[model samples]
Structures are given as structure tokens and as C-alpha cells.
Target: MSLPADLCERTLNRILAAHPDLVEQETPLASLTSPMSPAPVGSVRVFKGSAVAKVVYVGLVVPMIQLDSHMIFAFTPEDSAVPHFTLDSVYGGAYHAFHLDLIPRADLASHLPYLDAAFHPLSPVFESAAGIEGLTPAAIGPRQRAIMSPWMLVNRASEEAFAAITEHVDAYAAHWSGLVDKGLPDDVLAGLADTDLAARDTAVRANIFSRDVDPVWAQVSRLLGDETTDAIRAELVANG
Candidate 1:
């Protein structure tokens, strides 16, 4: 398996082990093959649980385009204010890009308590990983970056640098698992109503998955067709 595939697998394993109650869900996208490629090109799987509304994992390898990618989106219950977990690693041609983030459920600027409680613990690891050699900023535009957390690590890296970030990735995943178990502090949750939390989560998710907000989906649509791409998006934003 490729380095990115291995990292994604291990991170997913950790999440599964931490939450044994998770139940796998059926998906129409279980097997993906495009006419552009001879063999299977991609696959999607979904899981649901008490803490998680839906967890979507996707793998795509297109030999024709020299693209290898693995990504996961673990969304929390709409009623809860817990942030979502997302990781995407792709190797295209000679370059490699990986994105790791805990998608924020609230506006960090206005909700200081939520921001601190949920993301402060990751600051050290985020900063340290940023200093790693051979890691340059990714091609993602500022518009797309604005929707995610500030702690997001999205960068193109050399082979060595890509391998070096595995530990940091594990650290981020571990912190997210802790968040799932302990949840937000009482002070933070007390300030927000469950209805408001669900509303914000829905709005944010809609924006994140919007093709106008994220151009990547356009590329996906071209490869997998609009119908299939929308199905994948629906799985990612499904409200359990």
C-alpha cells in the first residue's frame, strides 16, 4: 500500500477501536469504477454511531492519471457541538498533498471557549508539523481554507516530509477521539442551545460540501458524474 493509504488505514483503525459501538452502513458507492480506467478506480464506505452521525471513507487510485488518494470524514451528531474529523491524502504525479483537520462547529472568533477547549490542545503539534522541511503550502485557495479550522494541516510535501507527518496525524486523530469521548466543556455547551448547534452544523456542512464553495467537487463530478458525486456528498452530510 502507498504511504497515504497506510496512514489513512491506521488512523481509521484507531477511530474504530476507540468506538466499538460503530455500525457499518450500506452505501451504493461501495464499489466505484469509471470507464476511463480499466480496473476499479475508487470505493466508498460508511459507518454510523452514537457520537458520529456518519463516517465516510473513500479511496481512489487512477493509474491513467497517476492519482492515489484516501480520505475520511467523520461527522458528529447534529445536536452535539462536537467538531467533525476530516483527513485527505493524495499523491498525484510527482507531488503529494495531505489535509488533516477537525472541522469546527462554531465560529472560532466569536466562540472563544469552544475554540480553546476543542483546538487549543492541537496547537503544539500543528506548529511543529508546519516547521517540517520540504512541506509547502497546498494549492487550496483561501476561500476553501476559511471554512475549516485554523489548525488544519494542508500542504504538499516531499516523500520524506510526507512520511514524517504520520506521528502528527496520529496525534490529531487521538485528540479528536478524546473530544468524542469527553465532549465539549460544560461552559461551552451551556452557552449554546441544542437547536442552535444543530442549525449551525447543518449550515456549515452545507457550505463545506457546496460545489461553489469547494471546487474539488467539480473535478469529482467530471470523473464520477454529478449523480454519484452528490450521493457521496449526501453521505458525508447525512444527519443521523
Candidate 2:
């Protein structure tokens, strides 16, 4: 529970450093507050880079810091076919859940080079992380498998497990930073407009928009009201 707050700040700092051009772009969710307290329950911002894509982060933090929910997603410019980063985490009580990956624009299995570059470098670290109870290997379940690459780290972990998880988080950050610095290739950029890649990418990001099953929303709503919960969901999918 305590880790999510620090993780949120650390993740944002790492991303800003990785993409220096990122500016604080506002969204409708900033004004919304938790029904439980006067202070804003959550915030949404766009981190836009000059050369790379615009990355958006939606963070929800509780007063006692008992429950924290945050997601950081990257949306590439229309002309780039690169996979954008996706990192979502929720911490409450003795449990924590994680979803981290460089979501592929297309089928992950079809992109061997990208997988090797992103996942292979961090493969050795996975064994130690798997030692946790709820977390298995890289992936599981159909929906996760479809959206996340096989190299991604998706699991539910105990609070104690999070200490080790930071290493995995740092590894993913390094890979993402490298990708942001590299940009896309000429051949991929050339065909981007001709293909429906941008549309596909947007649709993929839309999955996080509603997220009806998210327990954080229910908790926030119980503390606040329906309006606050609805605002959080809408701003998550909103474009900068």
C-alpha cells in the first residue's frame, strides 16, 4: 500500500527523464475529487515528447494511502508503428497487482526482434519474481495474453513481494527508455499512414478506459460518489 505512492512518483520521474520533451498537459479529471475528501482523489496528465509519442498517466491515491491505483500508457504518434509502454499497478492491504509491458502495435508473436530486444534482456530476473505466490510466469489468461507480450510481467503479489518487484520495474523502464531514444525506423514509418496501425493502437488503449472490474473505482465510489468514479474512467481514455 505504501509502495504505490512512491512508485507513482518514481515512475513519472523515470518517464520524464526518458522523454525530456514531455510537458504537463491537462485533462478533465484534474478537477474531480474523491467523495470521501476535499482533496482531489486522482489526476490525469499527458507527457508529450517532441520526437516520441505522448504518454498519459492516470493516478488515484487515497488519504490513508491504504489503496493506490495508477496506470501509465504510451500512445505513439500516428506515423510510428512502435509498441508503446503500458504499466498499471494497484496496491491495497496486503496485496498488490501489476501489469507491465511494451504493448505491441500488432501481434506480439509476429515481432521476434522486438520481443528479443525488450524481454530477453530481462529474462533472467523473471525466475526470482516468479517465486511469489500469486505471480506466475510472464503472462496468463486470454485477455492478458492477447494484449500483453509473452515477456511482460503480470501478476498479483503480496506486499512483501513488491520489494523485489522494483528491480523488474527498473528493468522495464530501462527497456522503455532505450525505445524512446531510438524512435521508429524509416520503413515502418513509411507504411504507417497506408495501414490501419494508428486505429488499431487506439482501440487497444481503449481497453483500459472503462475497466469496470477495477476494485479501486468501487472503493473510491464508496468513499466519494458515482460522479467521481465516472470522471476517472473517462479521463483515462481521453486524448491529450
Candidate 3:
């Protein structure tokens, strides 16, 4: 059983390296622990960059770095037509799933630039990812399905499969960084706010981090202490 702790670090390091200018915001809950473990359960970081968006990362791993518990990266709105840059992966015991995607701010079908860059180029490989279960492409809606790309994988993984997952994650993180690197002009951002974008943004985020929809709420709370864990979730799903 190989520990993929470096995988989580690789993703975080990639984001920080890719955007040297991002501000690392201080958070009270930087680290959390698992109820039954010696090392921390996971760690979290928040970064504020240019007009593009704010980046948030939360990751969990075993002390040996052998068992990657969970790793998540979310890039949220503040600038131009962009979806949240999100990546979710988990490998522990016999549970394995790999999901890497840029969730469209709205509908994927109409978000042409995103569609052209993220989906069209990568979907074929992702769609056919080997040994991945539940790699279903369904119509996006207000549910968790809304934020997922058709290529997202949910299955038991193999060694070769894990390696493939790591490679895709690295590339996809770079892909999302490029999309939001320059960000949109301030004037452009202000113009888009006319639709009460703030309210919508908050709602969209809450939907993403809401405990009702959180898969690891219980696990995280037990590990980090309910209060601290909830605070982290609040930060991730914050409103305008």
C-alpha cells in the first residue's frame, strides 16, 4: 500500500508555484487531526490572487504519507466568466476515487471558452479512464452533479490507475491556473456584477460546501473537532 501524501503536496505546491503572487491568507484552522491518528488529519490554506479568484485548498493524509485521505482545491469567482477550479481525490484503505475538473460557473454547454479548454481536450481520455467506476456524464443541475465533469471517476483503483490519476491532476491544475492567470479586467468584473452576481456566488458556494451535501462532514468533524471543522467549511463556502 503506497502512501500518496506527496500527491496532495504536489497539487498544493503546483498552485503556489504557478501563482507566486497569490496572497496566503491566515486562517485559524490550518491543521486538523483524525480521531484515531497520530499525525494531522488534513491541512487547509487560502490564497487571494489577482482579479481572477480566490483559491482554497484542504487536504488530508496519513502520517506515513502512504494513505492519501482526501485532497481538494477550489478556485472561486471574483473576476471574469470562470467556473470554480475544483479537484477532489481520495485514496484510503480500499476506497479510491479520482475527480479533477473545473466546474463551470454556470452551465457547461454554454460556457464556450471553458468547454473548449477543459472538456473538449481532456474528456476523451477522462471519459475512458480505466478501472474508474461511475464515470457517468449526466445533465448538470443544481446538485453536486452540476459541478462535476462527465469524466470524473469513482471506482476502486490499481497502482497503475493511481499513477494515471496523479498525472491527470498535475496537468489539470496547470490547465486551470492558465485559464485564470491574467484574470479579467476590473471594469469587466464590475459590469458582470449587475446581475447580483454576489448573491448567486454565495449560493453557488454554499451548495458546494453545505454540510447537507458534504461527503466527509462527519469524518472531518470528528477529526478536527466539530467547531473547527465547521469553520473551515464556512470559509470555503463563504459569501460575497
Q: Whole-model Cα lDDT per candidate?
A: 0.87, 0.65, 0.61
The parts of candidate 2 lying over 4 Å away from their true place are 63-65, 132-141, 184-195, 210-235
For model 3, the local distance difference test gives 0.61
Measured by TM-score, how close is model 2 to the native structure? 0.77
lDDT of 3 by residue, 56-162 (tens): 77777664534566555556553345556666566666555555676655445644554565456666556556545433332234456654565454454554566
- Looking at candidate 1, the ten consecutive residues that score lowest on lDDT are 190-199
TM-score of 1: 0.96
TM-score versus the correct structure, for each prediction: 0.96, 0.77, 0.75
lDDT tens digits, residue span 1-240, model 1: 998899888888888898888888887899887778777789998888888667789988887888899999988888877889999988988988899999988778888888889999999999999789999998888888899999999999998999999999999998999999998878898766433877888788889999899888898887888888898888776665
Error of 1 at 65 (Å): 0.7
Highest lDDT scorer: 1
Best by TM-score: 1
- Ranking 2 against 3 by TM-score, winner: 2
Number of clashes found in candidate 3? 1
